[model samples]
Target: MVDRTNADHDVLLTKEAEEQTKNNGLKKKMYKIAFVVQRYGLEINGGAEFLCRDVAEHLSKYCDIDVITTCAIDYVTWKNEYEAGETRINGVSVKRFPVDFPRETKRFDKCSEKVLCKTHSIDEEMEWMKLQGPYSTKLFKFIEDSKDQYDFFFFFTYLYCTTFFGLPLVADKAILVPAAHDEPPIYLSIFNDIFHKPKAIMYNTKEEKDFVIQKFRNGDIPHDVAGSGVSLSEKMESNNSHSLTRKESFITYMGRIDESKGCGELFDFFQRYKKENHSPIKLIMLGKTVMKIPTHQDIKYLGFVSEEEKYNTLQNCDVLIMPSKYESLSIVLLEAWLCKKPVLVNGQCEVLKGQCIRSNAGLWYENYEEFSECLNLLLADEHLRDQLGNEGRKFVDKHYSWETIERKYLDLIERV
Candidate 1:
């Protein structure tokens, strides 16, 4: 016997040690990430909320992700609309808390005018921030109590109470996805610490990053333009063209139908364009409307269609119109791109304009004349639309595919 007993003992011990090491490595790699947002639910169609949900769900495969949010469904009042408690939506754990008080629109509006429109003192600005409600103590309490549990925290949409208050408490561990735009809120000096204090920041586009840096000088902070993923149902790829099927040319508007989103201007422009041009193209409105859709035979309002339907409609349409002057990154633009469709954007939005220039995917309009010209041009030239759509798809493929985004996210988590 060539020392069989000793040989067996050595082999067993080696295997045990290797197993322990592997288990330890697995534990270390399994990051616990927390996503804090103001509102979340299936019914919520706002871009920020949707981005939060999609990212949380997708990242669940790589880490232990939990969503901390308020029970408010609507951003207007921040009323307790969703069930307040822990639940699992799309396989990710979510903890929802109640708002301390619902928002008084009139009071908040007055505060907004002073702080954003005119000027205000620090204390007054802070008061305005607090009045932008969903001031949930329990959420802060949870973060306070569970500081050691998560490796990192992501606060989405910088304009909310959850972000303003929660971000500072976890400043060392926070990664801000600001979803910011060049609005009056960005001018608030109160947000100086909010932008500069975070450990690292992520943005939706290069223009968003540039805008934030220009405003806050948070440029020194480690940040990148890690845009949201571009995903569409398979049905959209082979989408039916309305020109071939219905013999009608149409332009589709996606996103919230509200005055702030530049919907009123779009309607005015379209009404004038329709009356003057005598084109067969109809204007189709998608998503929830806050204002009454102008009653016209050529205008069609389809309330709150699912992403599948929206993308399907997107692929078939002559052009996609994003009229919003303020945008961080138009997910709708990316959606239109992925559907191999041309987009028409507000030239006033640098983010949108940047995307159009970078991708060469569509046109932008400054005035009704420009809008009418671009709309008519896109409708008239099928070959140009195809070329633009192809370029747009290439842009989306190069940057926003799931593989590219997931890798970027993992890199961020790894850095954290």
Candidate 2:
């Protein structure tokens, strides 16, 4: 069994103690955090990007935070005068630098390719370094040029882009949040082990925490597990559209339109069910499609909605179906819960399965039949849907809110 008592108390006390320290001025230091990621605000379409945006927004309130990334243009155009330099968004600063791509031995343009398990490796990481090294060099130069201007440096993602770039510059004072390590060629484990400096490491789930601890820490990971949950209530009142009615007859999936996300599977299931039963239930997909895939008849693709539209979609949907083959505890799932919508998750996500079972917020299924049965059950039973959604909302309120989770983040920062 896991040691829950000591761990839990340490978490609570650490959070409290940090607040106490800040109040006492024992830890009253304003931080300047340089968040180094591969892509900046324009390319924040995925889970990591979503989390990075949240962290940037929240941390900016406390620190002098600037996001350092590359211009999504090729070497020739990216080298243009207008593309190079720092710009401010809200209260945060962004430095976009020129990125050079290696010879096209493969199909990736490097200008607009998604980083995947296939893309993060010793060979690929070195290539990533070759491509992104100039940008990182400029980032480092920007930091070094303004040495006393910032106090902290935080990097997003583990094996590739940010880890190599941000770790060396900040050294011991750096923070690394390894989002999820599930997608792999197995060799990434070695890079993650060796390259991960003992500066504070943050994870999104207990599963990820344990995985890091087991592999890197010899069953003793000195890290804090943070829920990738966000602070939405502040914006909720202003952005709230309408309360969803029980009469709504639809299911939705939100995320990338990629094969690994199980979009094809969802479409196939919906097609079979629609043909067999003539169910009037609609299936809507939200988010941009990176690859060309076959479309479904009744599936409505609402590609890349705004934040307001995203919440609106979630608010109206009866059920959220997450069919990703590999997920590191989705922000979309948490958002679905926060919106009081029930989720139908793939059974492969053990962390999500634990969350569903423990909170009674949703259900899990292994195959098409089970998925179909769950969908049918949710469609037929209004009472069960309400109960599940209510449970999910409660769980999110207690555990996943930024007010609660931010304290833990602050405590970790104080420790370093």
Candidate 3:
């Protein structure tokens, strides 16, 4: 078995010896593995991108990991923004390939609006997926060519071109982390081939696994629901009071700011709440804002804070809000739990609702009335907030700890 323990820092070694050690690790027969992703970099903020990076980093402690990906940084236009070559990121080797062409998002969206959520022929569905680019034929060719080099392969998020195309080429060694949701694209028949072909599927939640088994008819395929883990830093502690962490209490939203994520609804509800209740609750947004955010004195949009800043912000927040309806796994919610903050999620999201009910860590709302009521209730009862926050932290500690999730990953690889 690969070693998951951190080597002693007391052991002094030359630079040459360090490089040699990494090379020797890669040469080992059982642990050498490749992660095939459509995008891999520090800048990209997509959940799947973060998931791949986090899992790869954690697994590297136990295995020889290599990431093969496209040079594209932005999902909108799959342009080769980063140089196409090999590099090491946080001790993991990453090789990026050039995208053959940039994606036409306009064409994809226009067609997607018509075809997705509606029945269509296999040919039509395949065409829509192809148009959902980061269409890296070069990346696929690399996977096929280097099939013998790695003992195992991990493909993340089944919706993309890389997993959909590359999984079949190395199905015997493939493990897919589909990150599937109850969305329209998942209903496509093409996914059945991709889903069943993988040696095993790592789901983020039991709800996601259920969604897949229902749609893909993959009862026979070996699968496990293991979500991404939250690594506890020395600074992170069980403290959820806004008065202790920030100058003013605020409600925070962290994720891509888009209508699809229900940011518009969040802002509208907050506005209504602001007028109705005279409390000085400010709304702070962190991350990419894709839609027009209404300019409100109480609402502040701070784009992309550092990891340290994010944790501090979470500690200071009244509660974390997840407005998105389409989420296979809400990493942000897990982060909030680690920070000991209660959460409010969309009731429309079965996975989110399921998580809240299972953990007793937060509340979910189906409409604005419910949303406002939940928030007001959470705000009024400090004891209840503290209780929920404690429960969430306990839940995260129990199931989503790095050690637990990492063990699951290693087991999956061993079975493969």
Candidate 4:
């Protein structure tokens, strides 16, 4: 009888121990993910960096997220602007390492001119990459040592030094978000290795995925069009206080006010339109300015704005114009659509053109004449603008909802 009681007690204890273990396993994180980017911060609004942050924060709901980045804010100079260490941003852990050296713009440009315009060896191209850098050996060493800690590492933007060097270290567990567009640097021989090394690739758009596959012939690697999501508020209040006048019907441009973004062309076209047609239409620009703003009463530059102000201004605008000729995916375009607004984009950009075609939510133009015509048409017909804007909102709802985006990412992670 004593032996029987002792055996029963042992069985009960064993069952309790097994139950505790099962409970602990259930509470463990689904996966550990690390996002590696060139720059990261609340203030850093560069496309690739911002995309990385958004994706990381969103994914944090399901898994553990860590952002490995450089202490740089300025992309042109690669100047270390953040403290070198780990910190939490909106719940995700961020590890920032100091940039080994700041970029010399003249030297980088000289190197670029040589590499792109003239015959260059792989060695020369690699040198150019180092020059176009947020290079940090400490960051690389940390990645190497800690590779086993994370289930996967997502390296954002193939153009940067961080992705170029860091992705190869954990190629077996690397997922490359190559925010590549139709650009000259991608044709370089060094990129062939970068494209092929990743375990998988996440593209911003189908256009980008197709372009990369054609350029790099990297179709064998698993890839998906896992674009980032745009979260919309339940109610968006349109505040017209930021405008010069509440009654003015203005078109707005939001992004880096730099020449490369086709802002120069936009300024020229808008100024010409104002001159040719004595219309009261104004051009309101908001973002960090890198180029000189033309001195014209019709063109207003509202440097940088808050999120609420941005959406409010978007709601007030007659149209949103994205004049950039090169884009993998324009988040602002999505934002404009989310606000139920029509957009005018540069047709020369295949991604932008394709998006416009796919969604039927915006118009595109290759030249100034087309720009003027499209602008006039959209402004003249309120019904047409409403139709396009409604279609855009539908497109965004079907495709870019946070739930859909998160599912795609989670599915890819599971599959890969």
Candidate 5:
């Protein structure tokens, strides 16, 4: 068993003393692990990237952790944003390699349209993958050269070039965190190779694990559904007089404001409900908006907010809305539950729907009618809202606590 509790003591032993202890067959092995991802930084709010950083930091307590990533920050164009070199962030070592070239959006979109909508050959799909890239030869070389240096290499997000190409180089020791959802790229022939090559897999949710198994027929691989952890903010515990005032009942959405996230559909449904019912309820959104937000009296967009402000707002809101149609695991959904708030999510997403059914902590909507009806039901009954919210908090505490998540990860690592 790994001496997780005595990591400090183990590190204090001198090199010669450690060698002597090892010669005596009494030394405990300290695992060295590497996390490979496309983009990594404090400001990168993308779901898979954030999860990689969080898990790396948490595991650093018991293992030697290093993050291998690209210098790009912008996912859309894969443009280099950070300096291409080694650095330390939050005590984790990060080594970044520059992307060979920034992506051309128009070309990539055209390629995607052809590959996704129309039948294409494997070569055409490979070309599309190149277009959809933060292709870094240097990163690949580093992984190939240093394969024996770490006990295992964890590749995050199956869609990225980093995992697509890098995993095969270190397949004997690669553990994939696919972070997959129902998407077009997943059905491609290349991904079969990526999925089958990993030594083991860490899935974010059971829905994702089932989906991948059914799609790739790779159920034989060792795997675990180890979802990311959520930590409660201390600021959320303290009362802030200047925080959002809940004079009228409101539903809040917190995430990247993009059309693909089902935000446009959410806006339409909310606006129609307001007009038809003449309800005093409002819709509040907090995130970086990538699309044009409709201007209206009932719709309010407060741009990117601080963690304290987010939790405080979540505490005040009647319902937290998660409109994203594709999610392996919604961290914000977990965050809302941590705040003891009920959530409203799109039912089309199997992961979100499964989470709701399992937790019994939120409501889902398939269409505008269902959306409006569920919203009205949650708004009209304060007792029902509180009941759901309390259930959600219990669910989060039971499954998503940091201790539970950390233990799951360490166990999986040891088993693999």
Candidate 6:
């Protein structure tokens, strides 16, 4: 029985100290853990990048944390640190590595900037980038260099970051928090048919947990199911609504606007709804727009709002319209619940189905017609939305916060 309360704050503890702490009432000493994020840091600003930053910071309160990542440069001028050498970031140590880039062309940086900034597709330009990009070779070398330093390793997304870096690092313990199982091939390539299977053992959500268990027979790979959580108290405080007009409000969608995320379906359905009924509710999408289609006028796209703006939008919206074709579990859904907002999720998602059934947080629709119908139903009734929203908040309070999720990781560390 390793004690979990007295986690080490600094200075890596010896094996004897660890044993003594475990034997005593103190929590196990904080292990020196390293995180591999290819991005700059918490301020890098994508959903996965932001989540990684937060999780690393929160975990650091209970463990000795460091981030081994790439440098924030146009080309590959990375070293063993951020500015020059190792630097501390909000109590977490950061070390950067140089990636392998090809023979210089000044045009490469401009093209890279265009692609990343979303100003130009640069899809064609990447052929040159492929020759020049240092991400792959540098990543492998960085992993090989730092394998012996950390006790545990974590990655925000698997296929892109972890599978490449973590696969080589033979750490005593490895954890991955895959936001959603994006595609079958990506995971299949990593862990074969049973990619997420080992992790199901550690997570609590039976829907995701058991589905993974049932999928794979390989019993050797050790993994644990992990989910991210937020402090609901802040959310609860913002749940009350002053704009509670019985008038049907606009349907809102918040997240990235890529096609795979069901953006096309959402737009088509919303357009059809507008054509059929003079619905008071308009469909609103709050995120970066990847497409250039001009048909979605009523479907307003507020590109990349700040945290305050996002919460404000969630608070004001009557119902959230989600059309994800596939999702492991969506953090956006949890955010909606925390705002006391009802969600309309696609029924195809196993995780969303379970969340809807378990919490009554919202409804699920299979097709565009059904999706339109469900939105209409919510529009027609305020009480239903209220009931669902309240229930959803209660469910979130009970299950989906960082406080609860962190304990699972702590337990796994102790047991492993």
Q: Residue-wise lDDT of candidate 5 within 325-352, one digit each (tens)? A: 8999999888888888899999999999
TM-score of candidate 4 versus the correct structure, residues matched by position? 0.92
Global lDDT scores for all candidate models: 0.83, 0.66, 0.84, 0.87, 0.86, 0.63
| Model 1 regions lying over 4 Å from their true place | 1-28, 235-247
Q: lDDT: which is higher, 3 or 6?
A: 3
The top-ranked prediction according to lDDT is: 4
Clashing residue pairs found in predicted model 1: none
lDDT of 2 by residue, 1-416 (tens): 11223331121224654575566344333555677765666435566656776777665545456787666422222332337677876556888765543324243345214233344545665554444433445655665565455555677776444456556656666677766655542244335553356467777888777766766653443468786655454444424543222244678888888777788777788888887775889887778775564566667776776676677777778899998767666788788888888999988777677678877999988898898888899988989988999998898888887655566677778777
Instruction: For model 2, state the Cα shift of residue 282 in Å.
Output: 1.2
lDDT of 3: 0.84
Which residue pairs in candidate 5 collide?
none
Model 6, 183-254: lDDT tens digits are 442333334422433232344355655655455543345546556675543533344322322233677888
Question: TM-scores of the models, in the given order?
Answer: 0.90, 0.80, 0.90, 0.92, 0.92, 0.75
lDDT by residue for model 4 (190-230), tens: 99899999989999999999999998899999888968788
> Between prediction 2 and prediction 5, which has the larger lDDT?
5
* Candidate 5 residue 12 C-alpha distance from true site, Å: 7.6
Q: In model 3, which range of ten residues has the least summed lDDT?
A: 2-11
Poorly placed runs, candidate 3 (over 4 Å): 1-29, 117-119, 234-245
| CA lDDT, candidate 3, residue 316 | 84
